[model samples]
Every structure is written in structure tokens, then in C-alpha cells.
Target chain A: MPFVTFLDYAGVAVFAATGALAASRKELDIIGFLFLASVTGIGGGTFRDLILGIPVFWVINRDYVWICASVAVLVFLTAHRFESRYKLLLWLDAVGISAFSVMGAAKGLVVTGSVSVAIITGMLTATFGGILRDLLAGEPSVLLRPEIYVTATLIGAAVYTGADIAGLAPLLASILGFVAAFIVRGGALRFGWTFPAYKGRPGRHPDDIP
Target chain B: MPFVTFLDYAGVAVFAATGALAASRKELDIIGFLFLASVTGIGGGTFRDLILGIPVFWVINRDYVWICASVAVLVFLTAHRFESRYKLLLWLDAVGISAFSVMGAAKGLVVTGSVSVAIITGMLTATFGGILRDLLAGEPSVLLRPEIYVTATLIGAAVYTGADIAGLAPLLASILGFVAAFIVRGGALRFGWTFPAYKGRPGRHPDDIP
Candidate 1:
């Protein structure tokens, strides 16, 4: 595989593992784990493609699906042994998120020719899948949290776009974007940094249950 | 309100109610119910628009959001009494489904000018919300069920396309499509008719699940 393909596969594995872990937290069965993993691995790219009016990438290329499945299976088999090792999981997720964020921005810029849209797409591509996983798992989505999830991705997207405009090679731009996102996310985690919550009100709840 | 707006509001209400019922079955809290109801109300249309490369309709149109919220709250309050007395929820759902199916097709056709694509969009718009609700509710998605769900929508889409091609008025074509879908779906439900399931075929999982 070429460098891009190799890195993309690695990112897929990490993201799929994150999905498997989320399913395990919810005590879902193996099938649920696989489904979650596949969605997390491909969700960002699908959103990008859908917005770009391109055919969804995974639907056209089966390799991504195959990798997701394999990773889910591997994670399921070895998950118990790694149950206590949460730091490693978080780091893996950070790496995958950073890489995917840059990749998403690059794809968006190439397809749409709009830097602002590319930035938004990059952030969405990085966080949307995890958000879905969290929502389905009945947790507060990262988007709703005070954490610097999308902010880190936005910074990375800006950096990547700027680098590309300055005539940097795509490979170099991607590597720098990935590093930028990873560092910001890691710093946020280390320092317990967060965005502002509405001073006191998280907003009133709607009356009546679903 | 225009006739189209009336139908659209009614459709939103019905879908929101359906979403509430699904969320109730899953025992979601009030906020979660709101979330599901909102998604169920707008989810399918959003998917269709996204695929067609448009800004999401709800984000652009505020009325859709308010109508769905109102309907969800009303249904949450009145479900037990209303469900027991009239037994009309099923009828209302069928009507809503048919109308939305036609509208979905019309919108897609107007945007893409492709009959096949319009039919697919119609089916998606009619059914995708239900799928989202089912998935989040941890129930099997309707798409995976051996059912004639898409078939009913397909008939409506074809009728609408044919009527439009023959120079029929848009309103008349829409009504014809809606009625065609309503009949097919109503018949299927009344007779407990469903599609044939694949026993030994593609997309089959291994026999490890219970």
C-alpha cells in the first residue's frame, strides 16, 4: 500500500477500536460492536461525500469496510485484556481523529473549492462519528460537552488549509495538521481545558418524555 | 398557510409522534425523547437534502422545527388517552408516510431531474427517519426487515413521475402518488404481508447470534 493508504488503514483500525470500546461500555453484542465500529470508521467520510454530492466513498471502495470489520473482530477478541488501559485507547483515538480531520479538510478543499466549508467539513468528519456513537450509547455527545473536541479539529483544518495555500506538499500539510490536532487535544486532556458552558444554564428541558 | 405547508406540518407532527412512541418503548428520558422525536421528524428529509448537496431544510426553515416540537409535546401528553379511544394512530401514520413519500420524490425529482434517483430519494425520505429511530432505540432497523416498506414508496414515486411526464398538474400528481402509497402500505399492514427473507444469501451473518 502507498503511504496514504497505509495511514488511512491505521486510522480506521484505531477508530474502529474506539467504536468497539464504546459498544462494550454499553454491553451490546458483537454484532452491535461491529456495526458501531464500521460507522465510526466511515461516518466522517460519508458525511463529507454526501455534502460534496459525491458517491459515498465506502460504498464505492470495499477495502475500508474490510478493514473496519477486521479491526472490530480483533478488538472484540482482545478487549478484555485491555479493559484497564484507557490512556492507550484515548491516545489512539486522538491520533485517528487528527489524521481524519486533516484528510477530510483536504478532500473538501479539493472537491468544493471553499476554504470555510473545508474547515467545517474537517471538524465534522473528525467528530461526527464519535458523536453518533456517544448519542446511540446514550451518553452526552462530545459536541455537547465543554471539551475542546471540534475546536482542536478546526485549528488543524486551518493549519492544513494555510499550508496547502502556501504550496506545501499534501503529505506535509496532512502531517502538520495531524500533529496540530493531536497536540491541542492532548493539551486539553492534560489540563482539563474546556469551552464555556452557558454560565449557569445548560438550557431548560422540554416538557414531556418521548 | 399554503396547501403544501399544511401537509408538511401534518407530516412533521405524525413523524414526531411516531418518534415519541419509539423513544417511549426504549424508555428514554425527556431530553432523549426530544432528541429522537426531532431526528425522526426531520432525519429522512435531511438525508435526502444532504445527498442532493443542499443545506439541510430544517436549519434553513424554522417552521419545521417548531411544528415538530409542538407535535412531539402534544403526543407525549395525549398518547395514552388518544391511543385507547380512537385507535387512529395507525391511520394517521399511514397518511403521513404517503404524503412524505410523495413530497420526498417530488423534491428529489425537481432537484436532480432523474426518475430513478427521485424514486430512491422518496423511499429514503419516507423510511430513513423510522430507521434512525429504530437504531437509536436499539431495535432492528426496518430496512433490514423482510418487508415491502420500500415497495410502497416506489409505487408512489413512479406514479408521481409518470403523472408529471404526462403534463398533469403538480398538486394532482402529488395527491395521486400519496394515495397510491397509502393504498399499498395500508394493504400490506392490514394483511400482514411482507417480503421474502433471504435464508442462504449475501449479507447473511454467521449463525453465532441467538
Candidate 2:
């Protein structure tokens, strides 16, 4: 299998595990774990495919679904074995997002031939799954955080698309994209790097209003 | 335009208005209103198209986007005019969902040629937009409610698809579907109809668990 394809599957597996863990927090049934896992792992890519007017990746290929189900079941059974599981999960999730972002941009570039749209596709592909997961779990979404999460995806997409446009090999451009996203996300995870929240009068906290 | 086409646009308009109202509650800016409105109007249909491996509706026809944006701007400017706006909004949303469910199933049949898949497409098309709206607005999702929201959509979809399969005329079948969904939702709205929650011993409330 090609390297990019391998990274896609690996990213999906780790993301599925994260979804299963989140489902456990809500005391959802076994079916919920499977459902959440499948959605979370592929949600971003599904959105990307839809916007690009292509067949969703997992529809024609059931292997992705099997991988997600396997990861979810594994997480469900052995969740208690690992200490500091949530922390580890976050780092793994960062890796998954990076992989997804690069792949998403590459796909977008191929489909649309527009770097700006491709960059947005990368950001959406990186973040939308976790957004869907939090929504399903009824938790506050990471999008609400004043973090550099989406920005990292943007940087990765832009770098990759720029390099590709500069006539670099697809493999090298993809590696650069993945490395850029991983570095930014790692900084955020390890050093708590975040963007400043909007503090203007119109952007007042909802609680402060009522 | 065909009657079904008109219902689709009407549904999109009303749903977009509801999304704008939701955004206003969070004090989101005008741009937020537009974003939420667009998502709320077409979110379900987009999912349906994606799953059926068809091109998304809005991307091909910019008219849908224009309608959603127009509704959002109208709602954002006049949200405070009514004293019981949310109550009115719920009734309007019910109408939109009913219309969307019928049309979605009809389109699904055209694309997938399976009544069962079409029924599911109807349900997703009716409820998913509101679900997306609530998630983006950081509010408690309607899916968590015991009320007959999704059930109403399911009823409409099943009724319509069944009628269509029974050789009913397309327009009549669609009308039956819309009426069925609207009645259930309207009844729930007026009488506070809801389902009983499962009160399992081991699966107690999350707050009560710890």
C-alpha cells in the first residue's frame, strides 16, 4: 500500500478509539460506541468528499468501516487498563488530525485546483470529526477553545499546496505538510499554545449577557 | 417549478430562519447568523446526497444558498419583534421538517431506487439540519429530548415511502407524508408529548453516577 493510504488508515484507527472513549463517558450503549467511532473517524473526510462532489471513500470500500469498528471494540474492552488515557488520547488525536489535514488538502487540490479552497478543506477535514464527536457526546466542542487547532491544519494545507504548486513531488509535499501540522499541534498539546479569544463588547460571553 | 421543488425551497427558508434565531441567542455576529442558517437549511440534504453518492444540492444550485442567506438576514434583523418567538419558531420548524422529509425521500427514491434507504434519507433530511444548528450554537441538542421529534420525521418518511411503493400518485404521497409528520410534531408542540426515558439501575444519570 502507498504511504499516504497507510497514514489515512492509521489516523482513522486512532480517531475511532478516541470516539469510543468519548462514548464511554456518556454511558452510551455498545451500538453508540460503534456509531460514534464510524462517524468520528470518517466525518471530516466525508465532508471533504461531499464538497468535492465525489463518492465518499468508505462507501465503495468497506475496509474503513471494519477498521473503525475494530478500533472501537478494542477501546471499549480495554479502556480501564491504561492510566492517563485521556492525555495519551489527545496526543494521538493530534497525529490523526495532522494526517487527515494533509490528505484532505491533497484531495481537494486534485478535485478543485484551487489552493484556498483546498486549505479550507484541510481545516475542515482535520477538525470536523472531533466537532461531530463532541456534538454527539453532548460535550463542549474543541472549536469553542481559543486554541491553535484549526490554524495548524490551515498551515499544513497551505504549505503542502504551495509546495505542490512549486512543482515538488507529491510525496515530498505531503511529508512537509504532515510535519508542519504535527509541529504546531504538538506545541499546542505540550506547551498550551492558544490564540487570544475575542474580548470585544459585541463578543461578550453568553453568561455575562443573561 | 414542481410542487416538490417549491416545498424544498420553503423548507430551506424556514429552517434557515430557525438557525439565525439560534445564533442570535449566542450573540453571534451577522456572519455567524449566515453560517448557521446555511448549515441548518441544507445540512440534512447535504448528508443525504453524500450518502447516496450524488452531488450536493447547494453547490450545483446557488439558489439554495441565496434563499438561506436571505432568510438569515431577515431573521437577524427582526428576531426581537415577537414576544414568543421560539414557540412560533418551533411550529414553523415543524412545517419545514415535514416538507423536507417528504421531498428528501422522493429524491432518495430517484437516486437509490430503494424504499428503505429513501425512508432513512427522509429522516436525516428532516432532522439533521436542526441537530447541526444546535451543535454549532452550543445548545442542548433536540435529539436528547424525549419528545417525538425524530419519531415524527420517521413517521412522515415511512408513510410517504410506503405510499409511493403502494402506487400512490407522487404528489398525493408527498402530501400524505408532510401531513403525517406535521401532525405528530404539532401535537408534540401543543401538548408536550414525549417518550419515557429508560431508567436502568446500572445506567443511572451521569451526575448521579459519581
Candidate 3:
């Protein structure tokens, strides 16, 4: 349980770093960086906890906020040195999604005892943060992209939920889930893997519809 | 209490109608309309309940989802007949924000007993649904629009919280809050009221920095 907690914090920190980097790109102030980082770090877990009808993870414990703030400040000061902050962000996000997806699934399984909800919570926890980050920052949303982002999280979540339901040890199940997510996301980053974009057929004219 | 519940359902229906209309503008199918409507209807309250550490209302009742779905279907069938769906959407949104802001503040006060939190929850409840709808529908977010949206919600929430704290009757306080929100939003819609947007200074060039 302590180890899982560590993974959660690690995931938060990595996500916060990405958020700060995003703010840096936008030339947002320190306060903006802190706000973005904190939201991106905790937003996913908050959504998952809410859906599970549990106390929000950050409300009871101030540590998560501090961690996000610290990561924000750190990234704010150091991000200018990086030649390719976008690449760094993608890698960090992959790590975050890997850790968070498994942890979210575990928490969902514990709370709901439903495999479907567990997998969904995992996907929500992994992707909602980035989605919020993009929306708030006025950047193009990750969901709009054709890349395999949520798909990676979904696969990892399903794997973890399946493993736990099948009586696999918790730690082993987590590792398998994390590796699966990371591999898929990493492949997308490295080789530009993507699902085919949806192409809607032309709509009938209103006059022709009748 | 029953009256407040009625207000909540009414607010949800109005919000869902706007969401479905947005889908119509985008030429989305019925399923897309349903998805957008449901999210726009319950998203804010869901956020409120989660933040308050209470069970999500829709998860417990299911009636909220039914309301959203039903509204979506109605809007899908009837929206094309409207001459200016955007105008109707704006007016309905105003009504929604008015009712939801007061109700959200009332819920927050009852649960947390914090005036500031109550006001914040009210604003979140009023605006978050619209934000989610715009994000999902790939439309320009209302938050990005300079019109006095959240400001109106804030005023309404503060008024309700102040009235409740000052020993005003619940029904009277809610009416005052709702009226305040609607008037402000109505003014914005009629007159195009807006707050001045932020304009950041040019950053120091890295190479020129000592």
C-alpha cells in the first residue's frame, strides 16, 4: 500500500512537471504554473475518487498539493534550459499514465468491486488530467489527436483489472499494467503510431432530410 | 426542498437542451447528441458532489441521466425548426446558470458550512457543464469568451451564501440568487458585456539576460 502511494506521488510529480512545461510554453506567470500543475497533477485522481464516492485524495492530504507546487516551481525555473520540452513532456506523461492507470484501477476495484468500473476509472485517471490541462491552456486537446493515448491507458487498465480479478498478486499485476501502458505510449511517441481518424459522411441538407 | 429539487431538474433540462443544440450545429448523430447532453446536464453537479465528498447524484438516482437523454432526444427532433438555435441556447444557458448557481451554493453550505466554498461550488456548478460541453463538441469555450459568465455565477453564489448566512429563508435566498444570475447573464447577452482580457508583457530574451 505504501509502495502504491509512492507510485501515486511519482505520477503526480511527473504530471505536474508536464503542466508546468505547458505553462512555460504559454509564458504564464508563476501562479499560473502552480495552478496548472496542481490541477493537472490532482485532477484525474479527483475525478476517479469522486466517481467512486470516496474522499478526494488531495483534500485529506496536503502532500499532493505540495508535491505539485514543488514540481511546478522546479519546472518553471529549469524548463528554459531544455531544447525540446515537448519531447520531455511526452516521456513524462507516458510515465505518469503508466503509474496512474494501474493505481486508479486498484482503487476502483477496492471501492466498487466491479471490473468495468475499475478499467474505466483507470482510463479516467490516466487521461483526464491531460485533457483538463489542454482545455485550460487553450492548447489542442490530446483527445482530438489521432494518436493512441487513451487507448494505451484503456489497455493497461483492462490488463490490470483482469489480472487482479484473476487472482494475480497486486504488485505483479501493477507492474504488468504499467509496462503495458508505457510500451504502447512509448511506441506512439517513438514511431508515431495512431488509430485511423474518424471521417464523418457528409450530412444531408435540412431540406432533403424530410 | 422539493422546490429546490425541481429547480435542479429544470436546470439540468435547460443545460441538456443547449448541449444537444450544440451537437446539432456540429451535425452530430443522435448518440453524439445524447453523450453531449448527458455530460452537459450533470457534469457540474457531479463536480460539486465529488468536491463535497458526497455520492454523485446521478449515480444514486439515474433520473438525472434520463432527464438529459430525454432532453437530447427532444432537442434533436425539434432543434432544426428553430430560426436561431444559438440565441435559444444562450437564453436557456442563462436560465440554467441562474438556477444551478443558487442550488450549488445551497448544497455547498449545507454540506461544508463554508461561505467561500459555497460560492465557489456554485460557480463550478453553473459553469463547468458548459465548459465540458464546449470541450467535447470542439467549440470555442465560454470561459475563453470575454462575456461575464463566471462573474455572474460568482455574484449569484455570493448573494445566496450571504442571504442564507444572514437568516433569510431558503426559498427567498434562492430566488434572489437566481434572479441576480439571470439579470447579469441577460445583460451580457443583450449588451455584449465583457471584462478586459489579460495582456502579458513581452518576456526577456534568454540570450540578452545577464
- The TM-score of chain B in candidate 2 is 0.93
List candidate 2 stretches off by more than 4 Å: A1-43, A50-123, A126-139, A142-210, B194-203, B206-210
List residue ranges in candidate 1 displaced over 4 A: A1-5, A85-89, A195-210, B1-128, B134-210
TM-score of chain A of 3: 0.92
Q: TM-scores, in order shown?
A: 0.56, 0.61, 0.61
Q: Rank order by lDDT, top first?
A: 3, 2, 1
lDDT of each: 0.71, 0.80, 0.84
lDDT of 2 by residue, A1-210 (tens): 766687788878878887888887777888998999899998988888878888889998889999999988888888778786667667777888888888888888888776766776777788788888888887777654544566677788888889899998888888898899999988988898875422222323323432
Error of 2 at B59 (Å): 3.3
Clashes of each: 0, 0, 0
Winner by DockQ between candidate 2 and candidate 1? 2
TM-score of chain A of 2: 0.92
Task: Tell me how large the interface RMSD of candidate 1 is.
Answer: 12.0
After superposition, the stretches of candidate 3 with alpha carbons farther than 4 Å from their true spots are A1-38, A48-53, A58-128, A141-210, B1-3, B29-32, B59-66, B201-210
Chain A accuracy as TM-score for every candidate: 0.89, 0.92, 0.92
Name the top TM-score candidate.
Answer: 2
**DockQ ranking, best first:** 2, 3, 1
Best by lDDT: 3
